[model samples]
Target: MKRVLIPVAFLFALFAGSGSAAAAPPIPVEPTTETLDCPGFQVDAVYTGKAKWIDAPVASGTKKRLKLFTGVAAASTATLTGPAPTSKVISLSLNGSISWSIVLSPEFDIVITGTGRNLISDPQHGDYPGGLFLTVGKVSWSLNAPDYPNGGITGPGSVTDVCALLAP
Candidate 1:
């Protein structure tokens, strides 16, 4: 009895002290439509996706969880369309995958991975209004709020302005 209790107590204490919350069920990203102002026309976009939400207070040794969202946008896609003054309705890839996940470190630094949409829109500062980014491999980016002023992105993926493709 003493030996059993000893192991049990240790296990309980370890988990109890971790200060981490259990992962929640995946959140369904419902289909939504939005219009984006392009250079000369308006871009109508339909977005759909899902994300497995997680909340971890702290990790084992580092003081924060290793990762939170895993199934986030693992299976996601998007559709975009634009007006055509010169021709009929213009459109890009009817269906495109836009999978991505966010990771928070001990220092609270955010790292986003996978192919998806990225926009650092700060009214005070200039923003990078990037549309769909597709890559053969994988794409990742480090986010710093104050860093983006002129609107830019540096990564391995090829950026496709859905608006441009649909524009006439």
Candidate 2:
């Protein structure tokens, strides 16, 4: 009886220590900022998003699953500068649904889809007011389980020419 109890006690101690040591800690996060530069254009925006852990916290690692969503009415606006010389300014509006998974982890992934809409503008060529207008379809991009330090996001489609009078 004594010999059997000794082995059982030792096994319990070993298991307990291993379990405590293998646990991971939760990862703290704050507001993050990201910049996206389009061809001939640049946009700077803040990420106001919400994140929730899918499981309990650990002591040496982070949560394996996380669900994230963009904040209410979170949007990014920028000015689209046309070709050189004239350097015409076109108001650019970007609204979308952004969701992330495995956030703050190496397996992090993101999916973003911009709400499609027409470009807002009021320009004149020659002597016509409101002679320039353009429309852009819904644009979407995503970052799947990408390779570390070498992942690439998809690009948006080209803008359609709706203002023939302002053609240069």
Candidate 3:
């Protein structure tokens, strides 16, 4: 009985300690800082657009905001990979005589347009937006699981502008 109990206790101790180590704490690790420098190329043609809409403010007694929509087209063969991602904003006029002035608040909002993919892309394609991203394309963009929560939440909170730019 003593001999059997000894082995059982040892086995229990080994597994009890191992379980804690296996369950790692959930802390986010920052991305690597190493930069990639790629040669630049001139674009022949380009097309892009952006739009944002906001509901009444979430908190108390805030003025209602507006939405933004802009588009552009460009035809060029620009290589789109480098140490850091590049981005640009295009502006569109409402073309109306409204008296209220609308401004884009620099807060982060998901860009839900194909022509303006600079905001997010498939992780496999090296265009994954870390905070929240949805796979608009039909390919594997990352080795790990893709993020899907932000896809459900929809609202333009801080953005107050719609713009676009395309050149040949």
- Displacement of residue 150 (Cα, Å) in model 2 is 18
Query: Once model 1 is optimally superposed onto the true structure by TM-score, how far is the C-alpha of residue 30 displaced, in angstroms?
Result: 4.4
Error in Å for residue 60 of model 1 = 3.3
Question: For residue 123, what is the lDDT in candidate 2?
Answer: 24
lDDT tens digits by residue: candidate 2, 1-168 = 000001111111222222222123222224343333222333332322222222223334455545432211123333344433554555434332222333445544444332343232222222222222223444333444221111112236344432332222
- The window of 10 residues in a row where model 1 has the poorest summed lDDT is 1-10
Residue 105 local lDDT, model 3: 42
Of the pair 2 and 3, which is ahead by TM-score?
2
Clash number by candidate, in order: 1, 10, 27
Evaluated at residue 34, the lDDT of candidate 3 is 20
TM-score of 2: 0.29
Report every candidate's CA lDDT.
0.36, 0.29, 0.21
Q: Give stretches of model 1 more than 4 Å off.
A: 1-30, 37-41, 48-58, 63-66, 74-76, 84-108, 115-132, 145-157
